[model samples]
Target: MELLPVRPTIKTPAQAFTGDVYMTPIHSGTGPSRMTVALVRFTPGARTNWHAHAVGQTLHVTEGVGLVGTRDGAVLRIHAGETVVCPPDEQHWHGAAADTFMSHLAMLEAKPDGGDPTTWLEPVADELYEKANQQ
Candidate 1:
């Protein structure tokens, strides 16, 4: 057994996120393992761009409240200690609720061939985001 070295937190790029978001690497598996995990923190009204994962993704909320929405206009409100699973290749976005900060463990697996697992699309429009918050 070995203890992994801690990685510095990074500010999520504006290309794929809105508002202030940060990510701390947790685990990135190698070789036989393909799992990846990160602790993602979002400030109030912050959220990710529309994206989809080749192998699906899971978010376990660790603090405050969050919102997860899909292209079908379905939005789910997640609270601390809750977990949400997004199906593979299903366009979606997730982030902090309008009035609170949020943190979650973002877990997903890399593509088997070692390619990027996520396909990031356009940012979630402000109107859609506001509608989500109102729901």
Candidate 2:
């Protein structure tokens, strides 16, 4: 097997996130492989917009605390070394809790035919964010 080339880290865009965030692509499979992996970091209170993966996604927390909220109003608190699996097309948002910086590895799968792997929706509202933080 060949070593993957090094790539620059990418700052998350304001349009896609609510607070300070960044990501480093670990492996975006080429050729026949359909997997993508990234190391994502979020500052306290930072979070992604609602989104979903075409195939599915798995997140493994590596440091600090994380919050994963689902459309059905389920908010899961994930600590370091914990893992969470989000089913395919299941809308959700994930980020750092209000009091800590957090980092996680997100593993996602692309569609077999090479279409868009993720569908990003609207940002999480302030009310929802507050509600989550209060939990």
Candidate 3:
């Protein structure tokens, strides 16, 4: 196997995210592999919009606390060294906790053809966020 070069970290677009978020490409699989990996860092109170993966998505928390919320109002708090797998087509959003900076390794398989592997929807509103985070 060949050694892969590090890719530049890109600030996540506001359309797909709220607040500050960045992503560093890890491995973009070649050919039919279609596997994509990135290290995503989220600032305090930052989060992604509602989204879904074409195949599926796996998130491994590396630092700080993270919040993974589904469309059903269930939000799970995941800590460092924890992992979460978001099933394909499951609309959900994830990001740093309200008071913490978080980072996670996001892994997913892209469509064999082309285009984005994830379908991004609307931003998670404050009311939803607050309600979802409630115990």
- Which candidate should be chosen as best, given lDDT against the real structure? 1
lDDT tens digits by residue: candidate 1, 1-135:
989898999999999999999999999999899999999999999999999999999999999999999999999999999999998999999999999999999999999999999999999999999999999
Q: What is the C-alpha lDDT of each candidate?
A: 0.98, 0.93, 0.92
Q: After superposing candidate 2, which stretches have Cα over 4 Å from the reference?
A: none
Ranking by lDDT: 1, 2, 3
Answer with 1 or 2, whichever has the higher TM-score: 1
TM-score of each: 0.99, 0.96, 0.95
TM-score of 3: 0.95
lDDT for position 71 in model 2: 93
Which one wins on TM-score? 1
Q: What is the lDDT of residue 57 in candidate 2?
A: 98
Going through the candidates in the order shown, the clash numbers are 0, 0, 0
Q: Which stretches of candidate 3 lie over 4 Å from their true place?
A: none
lDDT string, candidate 2, 47-87, tens digits: 99999998989999999998999999999999999999999
Name the regions of candidate 1 deviating beyond 4 angstroms.
Answer: none
